[model samples]
Target: MTYWAAIARKSFQGGSTVEVPLPSSPKLIGASLLPPKHDPFYSQLFELEIQRHTTIAKRFDFHGSMIDQLMALVSSKSNVKNPTRVEVVTALLNRCIVNAAKKNNDPLRPFILFMPFTIQNLLNPLLPHKLVENYLTFFLVPIPDEGDLEIPTLVSNIQKEKINYFRKYKGININQTISTISNDTEDFKQNNLANTRLTTSLCGYQFYDMDFGFGKPEKVSIGAMLIKYSMVLFDSPCKGGIDVVITLEEEVMPNFEIDEELNTFTSLDPSY
Candidate 1:
């Protein structure tokens, strides 16, 4: 039987303690979900369409309003109104890593992203207590030496890698993978878990909008962690907007805050 069919059967039969659905199966390969195994990825807040950049180079600028303009470019270029947030970020981060490499003069400088997935409804009964947070460790593979590539190509490359990752690690024991990384430092290095960036998701999650028969929450947050180089993606309280929280080092914070490209689309005032 196919791996997904087996998972479904186990989920219904109560044969397994963790009923990871087919969708969540790929992420179940371990490494990204455990915080202790990897460094903390940062988060950032981008204001919506606060400004625009005229130059083409500024579109992918990490420090400028380019990030705000990025979605529009991707949407228009790909003809997709609501492209996947994780995919977009993955593409942007890939470019950022490459740009940072040139600035830092490191040819092999690679960036990794730790992304989370929601598996709340994977179980048969869909009990709240059974919910599990699964994640994937994505390596920002090096781009070719060719000239500037488009966003669609960027998105497609990462998507293809995801499929390849699943096929390669199919049927691996998730718990064993985690334990191996925790116990064997060499294994962790081989898995590239030590050098990955972190990202979290709250898409389609509306705790901020939950009325509970009372007024909506004035503020909602996951609370701040001292983690650096991590990012969290959330469905913004504002309609048709997304809120990002990026944490960076004190020295790097200044560069990102004053980034002309980023601030173009981001509001002047940031929450954090």
Candidate 2:
């Protein structure tokens, strides 16, 4: 998988085959002769079943007009300058999810967002070849108690957390930072219980442009392997818009879907 991924990355960057290093040993592993002990159909069947039993995923669309309104709101109301679409959307989702938990008679706990950051741009002069492994780091944004805070305020707070983390780890070695964050993340999870949520943005990744010899994909989905209390944001087919796939406890989904503030800007289960 890593070998193929490396090749794909090189191809995406218009690099030649010579740029990628060959594997040291060439060994072929054949399929097992015996029947599988468990379900052998879907690789993630167990994981998906667990997710299905514990959570539900809801898809929502935020149109261009909605995004514009959010941008304007962030600009006029918050101290965060030029807030990106991802930031605003994340803030809104976080707020709505927390509100849903509150309405569901669940305790309002602080949120810890696991946001992914690419390190390719941060490298000096850049690497001669892309690394096969993930060149990504997670930004842990510890959200304060939502209370009655508005979207703009939440956006500003999220940005502040990101900026602080970046500045603190700016000159540190990437490997060291990753190790430290791993320890910190484990501690946070142990201490926070059901408070932490993972939020990832694949918006600007141009996933729609990929061609697997079947032409461009009409739509892309993350499928059923989702973490509970997590949200994944993607760029909508239409420009200046976003598609959010959020997973929450099945019981809390109803309240989240009908959230007045969220409904003001999002179209639930929207068809293209």
Candidate 3:
């Protein structure tokens, strides 16, 4: 057998894989025949239509020293200990977004932040090496509606939620959760998934190391922000720094841009 084929076989035999059932219908059904439902996933599509017209994108650069200072501050707090760079940054951005929403007089609703965690390492025993495909699991973090919480508290809350999720899903429980969520349409429909924010970090992906025959890129960016209420984090060209891209309603962008707390750590990237 080919070397690649042998490796694939071994991975499947490792017993970490979960079988996903096929969809109930192979053919597309007419919308007219379908019952109208208020699934958040489908509702977001309609919201996106309005968002595309009224949302704007902004990019901010956080210097390495500033990041260090923020991390130090977070560490000093008694509530949360040894907060990672990602957690600190996520907390800060989430707080800023919530504040901006309040400034815009947006309606009060529970906020859910969806963060993706890599599961490739978790399956290391099953696969000898990283596969050239997306292997991820998502955990949702609930953000407080009141944005007045201190940075340390925010970080602590996030850390606690993550810990609880991990403890509840130790080992193959995560695979089962993913399988059920993916296969059960009724469960998804019943859950309220609105007011959700998406976050992704491209750090440690080594984008700066790639060469396209013209030498390595000086900077990397996620060109356009198509999703509202989403944040993308990238490793800055300089080491130990991060570039954040945020999308919000145009009305809220002005207040968010000039947020006192946010401005203390980040500077607007004029090049963006």
By TM-score, who's the top model here? 3
Query: Alpha carbon lDDT of residue 258, candidate 3?
Result: 90
Tens digit of lDDT per residue, candidate 1, span 140-166?
333454332356567665565555545
Worst 10 residues of 1 by lDDT: 48-57
* Best-performing candidate as measured by lDDT: 2
Give all TM-scores, in the order shown. 0.52, 0.74, 0.74
Per-residue CA lDDT of model 3 for 221-245, tens digit only, reads: 8865566777888889877899999
The whole-model lDDT of each prediction reads 0.46, 0.69, 0.68
Candidate 3: clashing residue pairs, number: 0
RMSD value for candidate 2? 8.5
Superposed by TM-score, candidate 2 places the C-alpha of residue 124 at a distance from the truth, in angstroms, of 3.7
Question: Which residue runs does candidate 2 get wrong by more than 4 Å?
Answer: 1-53, 171-190, 270-272
For every model in order, what is the number of clashing pairs? 24, 0, 0
